[model samples]
Structures are given as structure tokens and as C-alpha cells.
Target chain A: MKALCWHGKNDIRYDTVPDPEIEHGRDAIIKVSSCAICGSDMHLYDHFIPTMEKGDVVGHEFMGEVMEVGAENKELKVGDRIVVPFTITCGECEQCRRGNFSVCERSNRNKSLADKMFGHAGAGLFGYSHLTGGYAGGQAEYVRVPFADKTHVKVPEGLTDEQVLFLGDIFPTGWQAAAQCDIQPTDTVAIWGAGPVGQFCIRSAVLLGARQVICIDNVPERLSMAEAGGAITINFDSESVLERLQELTHGKGPEKCIDAVGLEAHATRSLDSVYDRVKQAVMLESDRAHVLREMIYVCRPAGVLSIPGVYGGLVDKIPMGALMNKGLTVRTGQTHVKRWTDDLMNRIQEGQIDPSFVITHTVGLDQGPEMYKTFREKQDGCVKVVLKP
Target chain B: MSYSGKTSSSMSQSLGTSDKLARGIGWFSVGMGLFELFAPRTLTHALGMEGKETLVRACGMRQIISGIGALSDNPTPAIWSRVGGDALDIAALTPGLRDENPQKHNVELAMTFVAVTCAADLYCAQALHKRHKYPSSMVYDYSDRSGFYRLVADMHGAASDFEVPANMRAYPPMWAEFTPEKESGLL
Candidate 1:
């Protein structure tokens, strides 16, 4: 099997690796039909996440046909088509019972490592690093789906792979981010980042009845996609996000704000973003949380701040005073992928949104190495890249 | 059967090589601690650092503390404590390295052994420290209490009203009509 492996910083190789086999009674082997390069995967590619061994297979957003199943699995058969959630969970855990599958108490096999660091371990994630249980990802021809009966959702017959593939991570992540705002029909939502998750956030905010969606980004293509999702775009390079958002919201600022750009946010206009970049480079800080700070400042008093962005480590100089003084409510996490899959699937099935609209490029598995670089650099207007394995 | 629902054991059962090595060193500390605590004269004499039984006993107490700490829920601090103890051992054994007594060669051998252990201790200590500081790559970092667990507890409780709209029935332009390419032929 050929899969993308992380060799080191800035080094990704789509090379031949061992084929996956079902290793547990609740496991199943899936022949991946489609896989995607995600924004979070960029963290792994650039050595932003730790614990990636040289040959660890990479990729978490994928959907496929079941090739084999463990005997104890009751929900799925060998011939079923399914979308595997990025965060593996056991439906029986207390966390899973409360609909927080991303923090499933039982999934992380490397719980001790996580427990030592986090005081408790969360769920195991496919193709993520050892911090999430070191499970092999689905970037190859086949992958072992742990707790298959519990972690995978059966794709209905009518859907194309592209319509359902993102059910694994980003779509649900974007939806969860927007939904966390408790958007009212009259509320205005402001989002940072125009990447795929940000794009989905725009569409989701509209779906959830936001009166207006404001998207902030410097990328032309991503901003255009947000526009297609019925959002008003603010190019951070050309105009001030603070000024424009304040103007559009009648000086109250957006009632709902989403930070879709996680840790690697670049600042075109803000001097603080440049400082974040410099501090990140020198290891003075582990994450560049410029967008978070800006969102905290730009959001209205008592407004909801929802973060779909991925951030790791300690952030220096967070605007705690602003957050507290304004009575802001902040919500964020790894997407509880399973919690929203059913609703989003219904939306996709109903033509409410075509998730495929974000696909900027498509290629075979061999091009994965180059595509990773292309997606990371935002080259050729690449917002999202899908691979047919 | 299912890797999902089972609670992972804390005794380094399925941990990787590095964790296993750290546990191994931890057990070695316990053994050495017992030896020094129970037989300080015999243990100190063997290392060619004899005649200061009180210092040897104190070192044993430190080793026992560090060993217990290493095997605890968080081994990073304990591992570093072992590292500090190694530094002290090196400093204490320096005289043995130069003594003209017949046992000087024994001290040299012990120094070499301790040097190797120090390197291992440093490597494991740094690795554990990195893991402690940054659990994920820099992108998914959170403080000790700020990661997924607290985030879920704090935020999910607030968004409990979220649900798929009751009237959002499946409408037109079903999934079958969706296609990535412009040909519109796949459907």
C-alpha cells in the first residue's frame, strides 16, 4: 500500500507501506476510496505536532468501503460504505454518553502518556500523532478502523464520496463551531480564516439562520469561496477587519465570532501578528493566536466566540481582560465528529450545501507528497485537496 | 476485543520503547534504593566511595524518592530528579576517580556506568519534558487543565439546545445529483 508518511519537518513522502489488517474484534479493514488533506494535517507536516515517527502514516479525513470486519461488530457488514470519524470513540464511555465523543474516555490506547500530560486522555484519532493513540491513518489503500461498529457511520446509497467524505472532520468541525454560537436569525456572524473549515463555517452560519456572515482572510480564492457561501468577505490585506466589522455591525461588532484559522494565522495588517510569527519561530510561544486575540477584541460585548481553529500549547498575551470585561463566552474543541454527522449528512443529501464546492484540486494518492506542499503554501488557489486512493 | 472501551493500564503495559525504558530505570532506582537503604556500607564500599555512610544513606533516600516519583502518574519530574541525583553522584565520585588505592579502577568503572545511565536519564528526561510541555504539536496545545476535557465540560453544557431543525426535511437536489467535475455525467 502507498501512503503518505511523515519523515520530519517539511518532509512528506507518499511511499509504499504495509497493508492494514483488522487487529481487534471490534476492528474492520476499509479500502479507502477517497481521502483529503486537512488544515490540521499541516500541523503534522510542518512538525508543529509532536510524536510523529518517521514512517507514521498520515491522513484523517477519509471515506471508504469496508473490506473486512471483526466478528463482534454488529452495526456494519463487510460490503458497507462508511465514513470513519477522525476521533475514534467508544459509544459506551461517559464522555461519549454526553455527546463529547472527541473526548471519549476509552479510545486513547496511549492514555498514560496523555494522562501524564493532560491529566486525562481523550479519544484516539486516526492518522494523528501518538498524542491521540498513534492509530494509523487512512491515506493508504486500506486502513484498520478501530471500534468500527462504533466509530464509522454508514453512508447512504445515493451520496457520492465527495458529498460525504468531509463528514469525517472538517464539515462537522465547521458546523459545530457555528452551532456553538447559538446563532439567531437576526444575529450577525463574523469568521476568521477562509480555508475549508472557514468556508464551511460561512455556509453553516447561513444554514443556522444568521442574518449576515462576515469572512476575514487574505487569500483571494478562499475569500471567493466564502462569498459563494453567502458571506461578505473582508480582505485583511486591503481593509481593516476591525474597522469593517465594526462598520458592518453598526458599531456593536458581530454578535457571533468564529476563529477558523487555528494556530498558524498570518497577519497582513496587524503588527501583533508579525510579533506572533517571530515569537513562534524562536519558541517563545508554541502557538500564534493572533486571530483569537483579534476576535476577542472585535466581537461585540456579551457576544459568543466560537473557535473551530486548532491551537496547541500556551498562548502568550491573550486578551483576558477584554474577554472578561465584555462578558464574552468562548467555546472550542476538536470537533465531536459523530455528533453532527447525521444532521450534516441530511443537509448534504437535501442539497442544502454541496461540500464538494470547496474542492480546488484532486489527484491520485502518489501526488499526496506534492499536494501537501501545495495546500500548505496555498499555491494555485488551493483551498482543499482530495485524493482518490 | 475493542480497543475503544477498555481502560489502558498504567503499568507501561502497551507503552512504547521510551516509556518502557523510563519505567525500567525507575525499577532500577528502586532496587538501588533498597540496596543503599538496607546495606549502606556494603553498597558504598563497592562503589569505592566508602567512609561517608551518612552521605551514602542520604543519596539512597533521594533515590527512593525519585524512584517513587518516576513511577507515579507523571514521571517527568521524577525523571529529572533522577538526573539531578546522577549529577550529584558524579560530583561525589570524582575523588574516587583520582584515588591511588587499588579500588580506584572500581571507581572508574562505576563512573563509566553512571555516565551511561546519566545519558539515558537525560534523554528520557528531555523526551518526557517535551511531552509534558507540548502534548500535541504546537497547533493543538493546551495547558494542563485546558485541553479537550475542560473545553467539552465548559462549552458543551452551554450549547445543549443545538439540534437539527425539526422542519429540515430532505428536499430536492439529492446527493445523487452532486458531482465534483463539471461534466455532470457521474450522476
Candidate 2:
């Protein structure tokens, strides 16, 4: 059962495959142990999500044990342990009865190929491809999962699959991009990408209160893990992330931006990331959204941008006149990770923040193709790798 | 009272990296079908379609017979023959989206890279035809599963009236010290 497949743009092999079982009836079969390599699996290892295939497999965070189940998985059993998440909900639809389990609508059995490209079609993630329901992931020693008592959670005992393997997706996508910036107490926020979902959106915008976070990034160990999670960094290649977020928010700017860097955002000389890297190297744009047009040219006005960053296709200069002349709002999707993987697994059981301190490398599942090229070239200091299996 | 063909619970399992992404899109359809069947006038002036060499060698013999039917080995009919050779390379690049093709934006960037490789060959030929529609030696015999056991037993009381709120249960990990040999002794 080796796994980590993907094979294309920068390939990814560690192959050997096949093992996952319980093909539905509320499937189960875990056994994985641990897994990680995420930053949106480098958008399916650089082929920026064209519904990956060529030996798909890959990963989606992970956790383990349960080995087998399906008899209609009554809240799972065989060995138990768990973690799972990476979307795939079915906790009884109507958007999992309003808690919006990542827009469930019956776990995407490739929901008309992501409703013919994004027109609506969400849940069903694990391994993230086939639009979103080709399942088979958790960088394998087993996997399967599906439904299994509504996409797993369990894990109880004294935690540590690197403290609940990121409740299966960048700590519930940096705590749902800082709890959709409802953050008030005095606000501030900002974010962008200091990697590993901007170090869990700088410790979930200081555990959802904000008061000041900032972040941005050019990488010095992800702006020193967003300054050890207290934030206030920047470095967008040396200052000027909209003039150092308007001199650190003293000019009424970051009331809550986020954008955790999606769609391969990398710009050195700007001009709209060199016209989104020559319209994404020729095929005229699929998405680059220079930090969503600089979070609509610096948030604040009405604030709350959010994003959670993974983005896939078609994006060309989006500012919509500063989101309708400074009244902003935005919010994004893909992270209904069972509405915040159980209060971020009780904030990793009360210690509040330590998601394996952005793991900087762990290796094993055959060193998943060299820890996916050392976590997509953020090499050596590789902000988060994990694997294990 | 129902059963004739495709069963093993209506398929969907096959995953050896989806037969290596349908044999790496059937050897990239036999290397873009032998460079558009023997370089049809240098692959129609390198995809800008100059006098379409006999319709690019008839779309390079349907991409070398769907790149040898996606390099054989049951990848759902070679990922539906590379989704019918990506709809015949978008019907031969839709006549260079007309306007007398003076490289109509290089035939709209070669039909937007063949509509993003025909949406990655129609998402890996509908995920290898919905994973070989159930029959990888069917196991669970859910006795012809009565509508998936009445939709997970009527979504178990609406998944317990939408749970997730035991005062956001902050430190509940005690299942007999959640074992995996004490989580591999905290690794």
C-alpha cells in the first residue's frame, strides 16, 4: 500500500497502491497513522488542480487506526482512533442541516464534475481531485473512509497524531480563515501567507479575537512562523504589503483580510504578478489573484475579506471597484471541514496552539516523493511535511 | 428483482492511482499522437493551424487510436479513450475560431490548451468511469443494500440534530488513553 501517486507536473510517486476497502455503506478502514504535506498539496503538486489523476492517491492530512468497518458504520468501531475530515460530509444534507458541512449536498460523487466547473458542488474531498470525490487518499497504508459515521472525528485519548493531524486540513483551514473574520475586540487581522495556512492564520487570528495579527510573507521561515503566532511580520519580499499594511493598521486598514495565499501567488516585481505570470504561462489565467487583488486593495473600509486560499480556475483582476467602492465583505469556501473540526478539536485539547509547530519535515510513507520536493521547494526549513504512515 | 450487467454494487473502486491517470493520459495519447500523425506539416504550423495538414492528419489518427486505447489494462476503456480524444481535440481546434486564422491568438491559445486538456480528459475520464462501476470482487454484500440502508437510517436523526456543541468540548480525549500503543508513545 505505499501511495502518494499524482504523477505529472513535478510528478510524485511513492506508488505501490491498493488497500482501501469498505466501498461504501458508510465505509471506514483507516490504518494510516499520520500524514500531512498540504499547503493544498501544492495544488495537486503544481498542475494546479486539473482534477489530478495519473495514479491519483496523494493525501489529505490524515490520522489513523480503525482498519475496517462498514456494516453501516454505526459511529465507527474496529479499533477506532480516527481523525479523517478533509471534507466528505453526509451528516444528512440540507448542507448538513445548515452547519454547512462544506456544502455537502450528498458528498460529491463527482457532482457533475464539480457542477460543470464550480457552479455549485462542494464536499467530497480526501485527496482532493476528480473534482472532489475520487476519494482514496490519506497517503496510504489504508484509507477508504467515506461517510463512516459522518466523516470521522474520534481521536480522544491524549491527542498527538501531531495533535490531531490538523483536524484534517490546515487546522480547520486556519480556523476557517480566522472564523470568517468576525473578529472584533479591536480587530486588525491581515494574514496572507506565512505558509501552513499562514501558520494557522497566525494562531487563528490570535484565537479569534484579533486585536492585531498582520503576517504577510516572503518566507524567512514563514516570517518566523508568523512571529511565533503572535503575528506582525510582512516581508512581502521586504516591506510594502500595501505599505506595510498601512503602517501596521494605524491608518485604518486591516480590519480582517486573510487570503492565506491561494492559487500559487508568487510575485517579485508585481505588475499584477507579472500579469499573473504571463497569464499563468500562456493558457491565459486559471487563477493567481495577487493576494486577491491585494485583498481588494487593502481591506478596512468595511473589512472582512477572508479566503482560506486553494483557488482553482479563472480569475482576472478582481477588485470590482474595491468590492463596490469600499464596502467589502468577500468570504470564501472549501473549508466546511465539518464546521471547524470540533472546535478545532477543542483547541488541540486546550494547549491552544501547537499543530506540530508547522512540522518542518518528518518523512516516511516512502518519504512521499522526497517530501513532495521538500514541501514544494520551500526546501530545507520546509514548513510542515509529516508523512509517517 | 433487478440485475443484468454492471454490479458488484454499481462499481467505483479501482485506484492504482486511477490506473496511473489512465496510463498517463495514455502516454499523452501516444505523444500527442505521434506528433499529430507524422508531423502533419509540423503539426499544423505548430498548432496555429496553417492549412491544417489534412485536418492535422485526421487529428493524428484519433490520437493514435486513443493513445493505444489509453495504453490498455482496463483504465475504464482507456479513460473513455481519453474522453474521445478530448472531443477530437476540440473538434480540430474549432476551425481556428475563424476570422481567417492569422493565428487567431494562436487559435485561442491552442483552444485554451485543448480546454485545459479537455478538463483533464474529462476529469480522468469520469474518474475512470466512476471507478469501474462496482466489481473489484465485491465484498460487503449489503444484501442489495435497501437504498443504502434507508439513507444511513434516515441520516441518523439528522446526524443527531446537528451536534457539534458540547460547549465546544475543549479537552475530551480519554477513550482509555486513545491507544495506538499510546499514540506510538507520542512518536
Give me the candidate number with maximum TM-score: 1
Per-residue lDDT of model 2, residues B89-142, tens digit only? 778788777887676777778778878887887787786556434344433221
The candidate that wins on DockQ is 2
* Candidate 2: regions farther than 4 A off: A1-32, A47-157, A160-164, A167-184, A188-203, A206-208, A211-253, A262-289, A300-389, B1-127, B132-187
TM-scores for candidates 1 onward, in order: 0.68, 0.34
**Considering summed lDDT, which 10 consecutive residues are worst modelled in model 1 chain A?**
A373-382
Tens-place lDDT per residue, model 1, B34-81, is 777889898568766678788878888888888877765457788888
Query: Per-residue alpha-carbon lDDT of model 2 for A63-107, expressed as tens digits?
Result: 898978888778888898988888888888787887778889898
